[model samples]
Target: MGAVAKKELKQYFHSPVAYVCIGVLMALFGFFYTQVLISGSSSNISYVYSNMFVWCMLVIPILTMRTLSEERRNKTDQALLTAPVSTMGIAGGKFVGAFSIYGLAMTMSLIPAVVLSFVGKPNWGMIFGEYLGALFFGMAMTAIGIFVSSLTENPVIAAIGSLGIAIFLMVIDSVSSAVNNPVLSKVVSWISFSTRYQQFTSGTFDISSVVFFLSVTVAMLFLTSRRLESRRWN
Candidate 1:
């Protein structure tokens, strides 16, 4: 798994994907941080963190689109499958590789918060919660992107499919509220990623929300592994 993950990370850096994704995330983070500073808004950096969902929705697909789809398109996935590695290992490795790049970008976000601490006392606890929440959210999004990538050989299609799903999840909170059926609304709310993510921005450690993100991530990776297994047999 480590070898696979290293290979994926190497592939990302060798191409433009890693640079572009990380650059975009940093640029956006800086922009938001600047806005917050200029506006003299709340000293809490959670405000900047709250806007990260949009950034994840934009970059995660690009980071993961080629993970499996391009290998299959190039007829290289057969080699991987024939090697001494399980399908779940491959999926997990891919997820880790993509998530690492995102994690690095998120880590860099701390610089702004650190800088904020110099001028004004920032809420480290809330900042910590927001950071942790963002990583969990990114983990789930990366898994979803990998699963979408596993379903197609076309990288563009995989990216589009992942983006579509991300957008759907983003709006699901509003959809849940608008639903008339009580049971259906409850179910939709349960699955709404954005709603759960917001729970952490308040500086509280919510174990259930963390578990929900992990559960979704594991389920998506399992489905991706099953897809790979099917392809191996066929």
Candidate 2:
């Protein structure tokens, strides 16, 4: 696991792709933060966060598109499959690589909060909670992207697949809200990934929200491992 993790992390930083992804995300965040600042909003990042999720729809696919798909495309996966490494190790390595960069992205996101602090005493607790929520949600999104990357050799297809799933989850909040049946809508809201993100901006710090993000991440990573294992038989 350590070896795979090292190799994966190296691949992430050594290649120009990882830096490009990070650059794009930071640039987009800068753009959006400017929008927020210029709009003269107060005590409400819910709007920013809601739109930020849409940005993920574009950025996540870039980071995840090549994860496993590139290996298969280049036939490098043959070595990984035959290696003594467990399927879990391979998946774990990839997740760690992606998650590490995501952590970087999240930490970078704090720059605005720090700046805003000097501008006026922003709600530190709420901002921290929002960053926490963004980190967890980013993990889930990357896991889902890795899962899709496992299914195809085409990087473009993997990216498109990841984008579709991320966008679907993002829209579910609205879907739940629009539904007619109250009970069904309530249940749907529970499942709607974006809905869980609301607690952060609202400063709820709900444990259930954290659990839901982690749960999705675990389930998706497990599926990714199984998918890789299936390639052994193929």
Candidate 3:
């Protein structure tokens, strides 16, 4: 697993994909930071973090789209399946590789928070919570992308499929608001990613939300492994 992860991480750095994703994230973060600073909203980092969901939705697909798809496309998946590693190991390694890039990009984008600390008393608790939330959210999204990628040999198809799912998840919260049925609304809200994420933005460290994100990530990766295992047999 470690070897696979290292190889995937190396591949990420060897290509422009990782750099481009990081650059896009950094550019979005810079724009949000400037807007927040200019608007005198340094005290609240939630806006900046919340806005990042949109950017994550865009970049995560690009990052994970090629994970399994490229292997299949290049006829390398056979080697991976016949190797000593388990399917879960392969999926987990790819997840970690993609997530490491996501985490590093996010960490770099937190420079604005450090700068704000010098100027005024920023809510460190809220900032920490938001960052944690973003990390979990990104992990879940990346897992979903990985699962989507496993379903197709074409990276473009994988990206589009993942993007559609991401958009659906993002739109769930909005859709829930319009529903008048109480039970249905509650169910929809409960399933919405933003609903759980909002807790962290509000500086609330809800253990359940953390578990929910991790659970989704694990479930997706499990499904991805299953998909690969089936392909291995077929």
Candidate 4:
């Protein structure tokens, strides 16, 4: 699995996709960081990572859009399919590759936080919780992207399809809150990215949310593996 993951990681770095994804994420973070934070006013990140919801909505697709699709499109999947590896191995490799890219982007974004800590007493607790939430969010998004990638041979289609679903989840907060129906709103709110993750940024680490994210990530990966198996029959 390590060897397979390494190969997948290498492919990501070899192509321009990884670089483009990280660059776009960082650039957007910088742009949004300024808009969300005004100088000399609290100097906090209440809205910065909060606004990351939008970035995740669109970027997860870009990062995962090519995972399996490129292989199918190039017919390189034949080698993988015929290899002695299991379906879980293939899905795991792709998930690790996507997760690594997301991790790299998150690490790069930390430069600003490191810089800010020296000048003021930054909320380390909140930062830690925020990254935790981000990790879960990114993992779940990657899982979704991996599944999308398995569905099509076109990277463009994979990205767009994943993006559509991600965007829907991103705004579930507003939708659920506005509907004013207790039962339906509660269900939607529970599924909302902001609602599920709000406790993290609010300086409280909730185990249930963490577990939920992991469950979703695992479920998507499991589904992706099943899909790959089904494709062999088709």
Per-residue CA lDDT of candidate 2, range 1-234, in tens? 788778888998999878987887788777776676776663554555557766855687788888899999999999999999899889988988888887798788778756755655666777788778888888888899999999999999999998888778877767767878899888877877778887777888889988998998899989989998898778
Span of ten consecutive residues with least summed lDDT in model 2: 41-50
Residue 30 of model 4 has an lDDT of: 81
Q: Which candidate number would show the highest lDDT if scored against the true structure?
A: 3
Q: Give the Å shift of residue 61 in candidate 3.
A: 0.7
Give a tens-digit lDDT track for model 1, residues 37-156: 776754647778889777777789999999999999999999999889999999999998999999999999889878877777778888888889999989999999999999999999
Cα-based lDDT for every prediction = 0.89, 0.82, 0.90, 0.82
The regions of model 3 sitting more than 4 angstroms off are: none
lDDT of 2 at 109: 74
Candidate achieving higher TM-score, 1 or 2: 1
In the range 1-234, model 3's lDDT, one tens digit per residue, is 787899999999999999999999999988887787777867756889899987887899999999999999999999999999999999999999999999999899779788877876778888888999999999999999999999989999999999999889889877877877889888877778888888989889999889999999999999999998998899
- Looking at model 3, which ten-residue stretch has the lowest summed lDDT? 36-45
Instruction: Point out the worst 10-residue segment of candidate 4 by lDDT.
Output: 34-43
Each model's TM-score, in the order given?
A: 0.96, 0.91, 0.97, 0.93
Q: Which stretches of candidate 2 lie above 4 Å from their native place?
A: 39-47
Cα error of candidate 2 at position 203, Å: 0.6
Q: lDDT for model 4, on a 0 to 1 scale?
A: 0.82
